[model samples]
Target: MNGVENNLDIKTYDIPTDSDPVHDNPIISNILLSRGIVDRKQADLGLASLSHYDTLPDIKKAVKIISLAIEHNKNILIIGDYDADGATSTSVAVMGLQRLGAKNVRWLIPARLTMGYGLNNNLLEQIYQKKPNLIITVDNGISATETCQTLSEEGIEVIITDHHLPPETLPNATAIVNPKLAENEFALSNLSGVGVMFYVLIALRAYLSEQKILTQKINLADLLSLVAIGTLADLVPMDKNNRILVHNGLLKIKNQQCPMGVLQICQIANINPADINSVDIGFKIAPNINAAGRIHQMDVAVECLISSNYETCNKKAHELKKLNNQRKITSSKMKDEAESQLIGIKKILNSHHDLFGICLYDESWHEGIIGIIAGKICEQMNLPVIIFTNSYDDNILRGSARSTHKINLKNMLDNFYQIHKDKILKYGGHAMAAGLSIKKDFLTEFSLLFNQECGKLLKNKSLKKEILTDGQLNPVNRNPIFVRNLQEVMPWGMGLAEPVFYDDFIVLSYKILQNKFTKMFIKDKNGSSTWNVIYFGGVIDTKKGDEITIVYKLSINNFYNKPDVQLIVQNYTLK
Candidate 1:
C-alpha cells in the first residue's frame, strides 16, 4: 500500500497494544496474539500433550494385524511412495517393526520414472516377486482400491496407513487407517503419513505391553526425528498435534539423539544441528532426502534414515546431496520453460478474457519434477495449476495439480475422472494437490475441462495476489538477536506462518546474484537503520536511490559460529 503496485497487495494483522502475555517474548507474543492464541498453554508442543493414538479410527484393527505379524515373525514388506514423507514412513515402519520383534521386515518404494504413483500393475508384479506375508502401505494405497482388493484375494493382509483423503469408494484392504476416514472424529486428523505410521507403532507397542508379549522396550522418541522431518516436509497443517511431534523431534536432533544421517545432512547444508529450526528441516534436510526420490531411488534416503552408523550415513548423505544438485538444475530448466509458456499464455489472455485455472504440458518436462513446477506456478499465478509431462507409458502424460484456497484441485480432478472415466488412466491426491495420467492426445481437452471445473468452483471469486504481514518492524529490533529469538521461539509452517514484515526502504546499493536474484543494501525510510537484503525471486525494476516498499521474512546468515541478520525479500514494489 505504501509503494508502486507490482501486482502486489498488502494486509496487516492488528497487533494488540496491551494484551501481551507476560511470560513469553514480546515478538512471540505478537505472533501468538495475531493468530488468536490468548493462552500460551493451548499451544503445548510437548510430547505429553499429544492426542491419544486410540482416537484414530480402525487403529485397533490395524494394530491387531501388525501385532499378529510381529508375533509370528511373518515376512512384512513396506510399500512407500517416492517423496520425503514416504521415505520417512518406510524407514519408521521397517525399523519399528524390527524393534517390536518382527524378524523379517523389508521395504521398497515405487519408482516415479518406471512405476508411477501408488500400486500400479508394475508395482504389484514387483511386490509379488518379494513374496511377503503382509504388506503395509505408508503415504499411499488410500486410492488403490483394485490393487488392495487384488492383494486381499491373494490372502496377503494389507494395512494402509495414510493421511490423504479417501475416495468415494474406499479401498477394501484388511484395515484402512486414515484420519480423513473419521471426518474430524478425533483431534489427530491432520497427521502426515509418517505420523500415521508412527501412531501404528505406538499402538502396537501398547498392545504388546498389554498382552504381556513385550520382550525389549524402545523409546518411540528415538523415531521422532524421522517423524518430525516427514511431518514438516509434507507441509501438512502445523496443528498442535504435529507441532508436538516436531518439537520433540527437534529436541532429539538438537541433542544428537537422532540417527547419524539426519544430522549429517543438516551439517552438510551448513546448518548447526544444535540450533536447528523448522526451516532447516523443511528447506535443507528434507529436500536433500527428497532428492533421491525425485532424481534417483528413495531407497538411498530410506537406508540413510534407518541407519545408525556414522560413516555409512555420511556417505549416503553426500549421495543425496548430489542427487539434490541434479534435481535443482533440472527443476530450474523446467520452471523457466513453464514461465516462458505462461508469457505466451498472457499474450492470448485478452482473447480468453479471464482464466480461473492453468494447465500446461511439455514433452521435455521431467515427470518427477512436475509437481514442484505446478506448485511454484500456482503460487505465482494465484490460481489452481496443473502441469503435465511425458510419462513412462507411451502415449500417456502424467499431470500434477496444485490448488489455492479458492478451489479444491483434488475434488476437481475426481469430478473430471467421473465424467471422463474412460479417458483417464489413474488419478489420486488430496484437496490442495493431486496427480493423474491421461492419453497425450487428450491434453487439450483435459486442459479445457480443468479450467471449466476450476471456474465452476470459483463461481464469483476473483484472483487476488495478496501478502499478509505482521505490520512493520521497529528499528530497535532489527538485529541478529531478534532473528535468533524468533527462530528459537516456535515452529512455523502452513498454519503458523513464518514471520513476514513490510517496510519502506531506500536502496543504497544493488547487485545481481547468479544472474537472477537481486542483492541489495537498503536503509529504513524513517530510521537510518540498514541491513542487507536479497531478493531471491528475480531482478527488480527498482534502482539505487529509489524508495520502495518490500515484504520480507527475517533470516540469519551463520558463518563460522557468527550470525548476522539477513532480509529475504518476498515481494517488492518498485518506484
Candidate 2:
C-alpha cells in the first residue's frame, strides 16, 4: 500500500494517516481519517458548496430547448426508467416543472417486465396519445435512438437527460444533457440519471431567472435532498460533485424537512429521521420504491414522493412497505429456486469453483429477483456472477451481473458489447453492477461469448480480500458524548464510509444471544474502556482468555429509548 501498512497486526498498526490538525477539527478529522480523506483539501472538496452546482457541459443546448418549451407552453412528458435513479429523476422532472411554472408535465416509467428497459415503442404510444409537444427522457434516452426518432417523426422534440454510455449511434433528440457525452466538458462524468436531470433543472432555473419568469417563489436548493436521494440510491460513485450533493442533502434531511413523502416512508420503515444514512436510502427506501415499479405501477411510488399531505404520504408509505414485503417474499422464493437449480448443474458449479466468473440461467427463474441472486452469489463466492432468467414473452432474456474486487463489470461489458453488439438489445451500468438483455435463443452463445470476453478481463487471482482499518481508536472518543455526536453526522455512503476501528483485545465474556447473534465484552491493554460487541452470522471462533484483533464499527444502539454506544464486529482474527 502506498501510504499505509497492509499487515493485519493490530497492536503495531496506527491508522495509516492522521486527520488534518487545523481545518479538520479533531472530531471531523477522525471521521475523515476513517474514510481515508486525511488531507484537509480533500475534506474541503468533499464538503464543497452548492455554488459548485453550475451549468452542465450541455447546459446551453439543453436550456435553449427547455426555454422554448416553457415559452410555447409545451405538453412535455418525461420517460423514466424503473429503478431508484429513474424514480428520483421522474420526481425531479415533475417537481422542477411545477417550480418552473410549466403545466402539463407528466412522467411515464415502464414496467420492468412488460415494457422492458429504456424507451420502448409501447411507452412511445402512451406518450404520443397525450400529443406532447416534447418528450424528455430521464435515465434512459441515451440509448433509445430509434424511439427518439419515432417521437421526432410525430412532430415532438426530445431532450435527453441521462448518464449512461452512448451507443454507436446517438439519439437525435433536441439536446442531450449527459456528462458522458464526448461533447461534455462537465468535471464529473459519472453523474447518475437523477444527477443529470438535476443539472437540467439547474439550467432551467437559470433560464427562467434570465427571462425574469420568477412568477413563482422557489429555491432550487430545496430540492438538493431529492437529488442526493436519487444519486445515492443509484449507486453513482461519490466523486467531488456527488459528495457535495449528498452532503447538502444530508444537511436538509438532518433538519427534518425533506420531502414529506420520503419522510413518511422513512418513518414507516422505522428509520430514525436523524440517522438516515446512504445505506438507509439504498437498502431500505430504494428497494421499496423500486418494488412498486418492478411488479406493479410506479404511480404509487411517484405519488409517495410528491404527496404533501401527511395522510396520503403515510397511506402510500404503508402500501409501499407492504409491496416491499411482498417483493422480498417473492424474491426469496425465486432466489432459493435459482440457487437450487445452480446446485444441480455440476459442471457450472465446478467451473465456478475454479474460474473467476459464474453464469447460470434457468428458464423458470423470475427476472425481477435474478439481479438480487446474482449479487448474493457474487458476495458469497468473491467472483463475478451473472444470473439469467427467461421471460414469459417470446425471445426475451434479462440478466444481472455483479463483480468482486478485481473486475470492473461495466468496462468488461463494454468490451463484450463491442464484440456482440448484434446480439445485445440494450445494456448500461456501472463498475460493480449491470443489467442487460438478449434474445432467448442466443442465450447459450451469449454465455460462451461473455465468458470468453471476461476471460481476458479477469485473469488475476492475487486480489487479496483485506479489510482496511482506520487503525486504533482514541479512548476518549468512544464515550456517550462523542458517539452520540457521530450519530447525528451520518447518512454516509460510497465515497464516505462510516468510521471503523481495530484493536487487540482480550475477550472477557462471550454469550450467544438469540442463537443467531454472538455478543461479547472485551478490553484492550491500553486501559481502553470495556466494549460490548455484537456479531451476526455463525458462532465466533474466539473464547474467553483468547486474544484476538477485532475490526468493528462504532454505533449508538438505541434500546428502549436508552442510548448506549456499542461496537459491531465485522471480522476477527486469532492473535
By lDDT, who's the top model here?
1
Per model, how many backbone clashes are there? 0, 1
Models 1 onward score TM values of 0.93, 0.84
Candidate 2: segments with Cα more than 4 A from true spot: 1-42, 45-48, 51-55, 182-188, 335-355, 394-396, 411-430, 438-460, 474-476, 484-491, 503-550, 569-575
Clashing pairs in 2: 277-491
How far off is residue 301 in model 1, in Å? 0.3
The lDDT for every candidate, in the order shown, is 0.85, 0.73
The TM-score measured for candidate 2 stands at: 0.84
Pairs with backbone N, CA or C atoms under 3 Å apart (clashes), candidate 1:
none
Task: Please give the lDDT score at residue 184 for candidate 1.
Answer: 58
Scanning candidate 1 in windows of ten residues, the lowest lDDT window is 1-10
Across 19-123, the per-residue lDDT of candidate 2 in tens digits comes to: 345232465555555555556555453443443334455668877787778778888888888887888788888888777878778888888777877687778
